[model samples]
Target: MHFLKAATIAILSPLVSATCTPWSTPGTCTATSSSCDFYTCLESKSGCGPTGYELGYALPFCNAITAVSSNLSVNGQAWYSATKLCLQNALSVEASCETSCTNIYLNAFASHVPCYLDSGFCELSGADLKVFFQVVGVAGVTSNDGLALFGAVLQGCVTKYQNGQVNMGWTKWLVRTLNGEI
Candidate 1:
C-alpha cells in the first residue's frame, strides 16, 4: 500500500530532470538544478556544460570540492543524505542508519536547501552539515565507526558518479522498484 501510494504520487507528480543542461544566468536556477548541474559537471571529469553555457563546477579539482562543500551547503547536505540513503539501501544489508539523528540531519538540510536566489549562492555554511553527518551512524563509540563508514560510502558514491558508474540520485530507482518496474 505504501509503495502504491508513493508510486502513484511519483507517477502523477512533476519531476525535475537535467544533465549537462545549461543555466547561463547565475541565480536563475533552483538549488536542485544547481546541484544537478554541479553533479553533471563533476561527472564529466574532463569536460561538461552546454556549448554556450559556463560550467557549474569549473573550479580546479580541489577548489570544486571546496566550492561544493562550502559555497553550496544545500548541495553538500543533499550529497550527504543521498549518499547515506544509497548506502543504507545498497550496502548496509544487516545495518540500517535511519534513526532520529538521520531525520534530524535531513530536516536540518531541508531548512538550508530551499532558499536559492538568482546568484547561485546559498548563505549556509558546510560546518553545520559536517556536524550533522558526524552523528548519524549510531550511538556511542559505535557511532564513530558508523560515521567513518558513512563518510567513506559517501565519497565512494561521489567517486563512482564521477567515473560514470552511477546516477546522482535514487528516487527514480525507488519508484520503479516499488512499482515492480525496475
Candidate 2:
C-alpha cells in the first residue's frame, strides 16, 4: 500500500501543483513575488521616455503577439498590428495628435483607432494582449501610484484570466477604449 501510494503521489504531483504561465496583465502581476512586475521594475530603463516608465519592454511582447496572432487566427489583422505598434510605443504614445498629455494612452488609443472600423476587432483572445491594454491604459496614470494598490489590481486580473473569467466583454471595452469612443 505504501509503495502504491508513493507512486500515485509522484504521478499526480505535477497535476496538483500546476501553475499558470505569464500573468494575465500587469495588474494581475501586482504582488511582491509576481514575475509580472517587469514593467514596474523598469523605472530607469529609459523606454518609458521622459515620463520615467518603461514602454520599451512592449517590443518583445509585441513580437511574441505578432506570432501568436497569426497562429491563433486573430480576428482583425490590421488592428492587431496597430495595437502591437501602440504597445511598442506605449511610453510616449498619446490619444490623439491634437491632444497631448504625459500619458502614452492617448497615443496608443489614437494609433489603434487609425486601423479600426465600425466593427473591426483586434485579436485579444490571448492573455498577453489583454494585459497590454490594461497596463498601457494606465501607464501614465499609475506611474506614480502605490505599488501595493497596483499589485492588487494586477493580481486580481491575473487570477481572473487564469480562471477563464475574461471574455469578449473586456476585449470589446479595450477596442472601444482604444477607439476613443468609450
The candidate that achieves the highest TM-score relative to the unseen native structure: 2
Per-candidate TM-scores read 0.20, 0.27
Where does candidate 1 stray beyond 4 Å? 1-72, 88-125, 137-144, 147-182
Question: What TM-score quantifies how close candidate 1 is to the native fold?
Answer: 0.20
In candidate 2, what are the lDDT values of residues 1-182, reduced to their tens digit? 22233334435644764333332223221122112233443323223554432344333434444444544333544456554443334322121122222233233332332222221332244554454454345553355332332343444444444455544544446545656988
Model 1: per-residue Cα lDDT over 1-182, one tens digit each: 22233234334433634233332333321123223343233224323334211232112322334344443356555554453333222211111212222222222222221221112112123464344434322351145433443343444444444555554354234334656997
- The total number of steric clashes, by the backbone 3 Å criterion, in model 2 comes to 13
Q: How accurate is candidate 2 locally (lDDT)?
A: 0.37
lDDT of 1 at 34: 29
Q: Which RMSD values do the candidates have, in order?
A: 18.8, 20.1
